[model samples]
Target chain A: MKLKDILFVAITAVLFGIVYLGAVYMGAALTGILTPMGLGIYGYEPFYGIWFLAAVFTTYVLQKPGVGIIAEMLAALLEVLMGNFFGPIIFISGFIQGLGSEIGFAVFRYKKYSLQSTMLAATGCTVLSFIWTGIRSQYWTLSPMVVLGIFVIRLASALIICGFGCKLLADGLAKAGVLKGYALGLGQMTLEEE
Target chain B: MEKLNPFLKGVSILVCGLILSFSYSVLLNGGIIAVSLILLLFFSKARLTSLVKILVPAFVAAVSIFFTGMMFTSGSAIAPEAVSKVESLNFEVMSYSMTSVYNAIQLSSRILAFAGLGVLFAMTTDGEEFVKSLMHQCRLKPKYAYGVLAAFHLLPCIREEFAKAQMAFRVRGIPVTPFSMKPVFAMLVNTVHWSEHVAMAMESKGFDGEGARTYYTVTVIRWYDWCFLAVTVSLLVSGTFLLPF
Candidate 1:
């Protein structure tokens, strides 16, 4: 990658972190509205875990190995600094979710950009996040029905937002020419021409 | 000109959050004393507007929970065989309903406590000062810290963009409901694109990723911060022993 590409990636990661924090706060506000409707049981809904989408989109466009984790950690750090309600728990969840997405990238050897790969990465993250939620919260003590409902909502969120959302973002960035370097290897062209 | 120091402002937020959270937990555990403590804290803050905001949601949640508990619970005793035979079909349904209601009440209380604390924190704290403290006192990297601050400041910009996008959609005869994920997704993509350009422009300016950075402002940890931390720790510790419910 060119110096510009590296720089852009870093900058994007930081911006993504900020956006992620804002999304979480917005999500919390929405949670207040939805809770009374019995729809709030799916924790992290409304905001739909948009940070995960941000991570997936960043990594997919940058096609970098640690992008997912770095973006997520930055976002979590930002959220904590912003005084999120869950405090330490937000940091812990960020680490787990980042690792989950990073694993998917590693499995593909950081060479793939297909929708299927992105979806797999998202699903992997969903499962990891779900497991963590169950262990961290009182989810284990709940009845089977409640547990099942939580799992379905989380999984659907991951697929719908992180999976599909990343694809849509990548496509848009490509159209805008901003993603030409990492995603399309256009950086190589600029170097060759120079 | 009643301006509180940013660090002190942050400490107060943390203090209020801990108090609210502890009292909430105590109340959940059914400790009347804990509930009283929470009410006391609420009164001392003298934030009438904030109290109203918190009360509306908390009251709604509490009522919903109570009703849910009542709906799903089975009464104290099982019906006798004769009564069971007469009400056999209805008994199981009633029991299930009551159980769901009870579960809802418990869940609602927990959620309310967390939500209340969140609202309280957001209302009292200075966002920029919080970021500055994180960088200076908390040892966060300047690059990342500033980026977060920038994003926070950029929120209004994003909202403006979202509004513009919605207007554009309406002009195109597209629906603009918040529930419609399609418009939201489109708006997000546009926002990200805008952010990328802004990031690139920032990079083009001699913004190199290098050396020790100096802060334009400093955050000193004061006696209030220490006292706040001590009170928070004590409250949390005492809460463990007191079991409100």
Candidate 2:
């Protein structure tokens, strides 16, 4: 990666680290509120998308092979530095999720930035995270149907948030002319054309 | 503990944490938590006060995750026979289930162990050393490693700049909520600009991003690292998987 790109990833990771912290705090609270009602993992559906946006947006902006993993892992490292209770697990989680989200761009061999590619990343995250969290969170204890329901909800969250949400944010930046020099920025392959 | 390579410490923590997370034996989890806490308290650099600082919040997180885990209602998660023996108690606005409560205790205790592993790693490992090890042991390119290293050193400066930017916004009468997009836009624009400038400046200073570079510091894994690795891996393997479930 270019030095500029590397530094940009670092800055983006730090900024998103703050966002992750807030989202996690809120997600935990929602879990607390919803658990009594037997809503289970479904309560956390909204927050799942926010977790992978850093990876998605960074990959979208840089269009590099490993920027997604690096950005996501760095964000998790920042979370550790910021004193998140989950500590090293956050980094582990970031590694898995980022790799999963990178599938969208990777499937096209980093060439395609289409909406379809982005949605694939979300669906990828949903499937990967389902297996990953199932073991850790003991989701197997829940009925198969409920586990399946939670997985579906997570997929929608990833689709809407990482896929569409990141698309909008990047485009908003692109249209404002801030992402001028970047590869997939507004000057090249504008979202309108896509 | 102090003698172990930073990278080695990271790997050890990660290995044990994975082992702990992979299984659902509440007894093993609790045992690991108890032993790790004692080892960290005595042998690691962490003080009791700091351990408590991380643990208290972890406790809260564990409680939340535990209850959430219980609501899964899987047939095998908790015995179907225990469902009827369940009772409910409402604390005015909140309700609880006896079976759910039992599962919550198991899950929460595991979370506590999970959190404790993190604390052990963070408390013992120095961030800079870990970064340096990444460069030497992991063979991370100078461009990325130094880029991140510089970013780590410049964190305080970044905070200052962000604060200054917020103050400027306040003075300019711009409405800024924490979740607002405008601020995020501004931050990204500035970060990109700064990254470009710094990259150019470093290149001009003869800091090439490519080719082989000699390291000023070395992070050789010592005997203690080997011992630590053996002890942790064996303990995790035997304790988590070998025990009868």
Candidate 3:
């Protein structure tokens, strides 16, 4: 690992952290206002799944194997450092979520950036998140119907925000000429071509 | 300034977080006294900045709780005749609905308490030093740890970009208000794009996520670290005992 790469990852991680924190605060506030009105679940759903955007951004920009993991971990670390309510829980989630998205890239052998891959990444992450929620018993006492509802909402949110959302962001960056060397690289070589 | 070793600080924060969580679940039922004691150390160590950081979340929580409680309990009367004589209403359903809302409010406050403790820790600690300690004491991989450090520094840059994005929107006659989806979406898109650039630059520098790495800064654990760890363990133990469950 060259010093420059280390520095780059570090810088990206910090940016990811700040974004994660801001999103969490906004998500929490949204949840507070919406819960009484029957819209609370969507608030947490979108923010949690949005971590995949960080993963995709890191993977797309870094164009490396572990960037996803490192970015996710950095965001988790920052969230913890900033005093998130869940503390270590954020770390664990980051680790798992990072791995989930990273695995999607790994499956393609880090050679593809198709919309299908993005969708797979989203699905992978949502599955991992669901497992974590089950282990933490976040859904333990809820009836089967409620548990199913949470799962469906979480999956839909991830697909929309992380899957399609990441694609949109990447395409915009490509258009702006910021991603010339990476997989989302400009001109005809971009993921949009696939 | 006397600095608490980074490892010790990290450990202490984690422990405090756990204790706070436990206290909220078990001891919170005992009322303000229990909550105050649970948070006493945090309060003593808090600075003005930390207090201000928590104020918004606290205020929101308080209002939510009050409204939820009012909605639920307004119909309940101590006297049996008071309910029917007052007016026939959907008292049972209202009460049931309020119970869930009240529980949510209580949960929100507990969340605020957790967030407050976190803000206190973040305000008191230094990011660079903390990463150094993680590397030295915890033996965290240098590449990963430094990556985190870099991310911390870039936060300001991202914030600046976020502001610029908002300003540009405002210039275009778009309203950039809180809870507005347009500005938030625009910012989100821009952030993802910037991060991609950051990643590519890192890749160009040969950051393949493997191989040995080195660092210039050193972090060491001292006697104070051990003391902090001991205090954390003791607090956890006592908290467990005091737990209502």
User: Which parts of model 1 have CA positions greater than 4 angstroms off?
Assistant: A1-51, A73-89, A135-137, A181-194, B1-46, B54-106, B168-193, B200-209, B242-245
Report the Cα interface RMSD of each model, rounded to 1 decimal.
6.4, 2.6, 6.8
Q: Rank all candidate structures by their TM-score, best first, as comma-separated numbers.
A: 2, 1, 3
Better of 1 and 2 by lDDT: 2
lDDT of 3 by residue, B1-245 (tens): 12568667656656665555445342442332244334544434655555565556555544554443333332232235534454547884554465545544554455554454445445455666777787788877766665565556566766787788788889999888855656555665565555456556766887654666665767677787688668756765675566653
lDDT of 1 by residue, B197-243 (tens): 65566568755434475668887776766775576557655765676
Error in Å for residue B13 of model 3: 4.3
lDDT of 2 by residue, A1-194 (tens): 77877777777777666666677677767766766665634556777888888888888887778878888787776666565666667778888888887887799998888688778887777788778888887766656887787888888888998889888877777776667767767446565677
Q: Once model 1 is optimally superposed onto the true structure by TM-score, how far is the C-alpha of residue B243 displaced, in angstroms?
A: 2.5
In model 1, state the lDDT of residue B183.
56
Clashes of each: 15, 2, 12
TM-score (C-alpha, index-matched) for candidate 2:
0.86
**Fnat: each model in turn:** 0.06, 0.47, 0.18
* TM-score of every model versus the real structure: 0.69, 0.86, 0.68
- Chain A of candidate 1 compared with the true chain A, TM-score: 0.78
Place model 1 in a CAPRI quality band. incorrect
lDDT of each: 0.58, 0.74, 0.61
Please give the TM-score that candidate 1 achieves against the real structure: 0.69
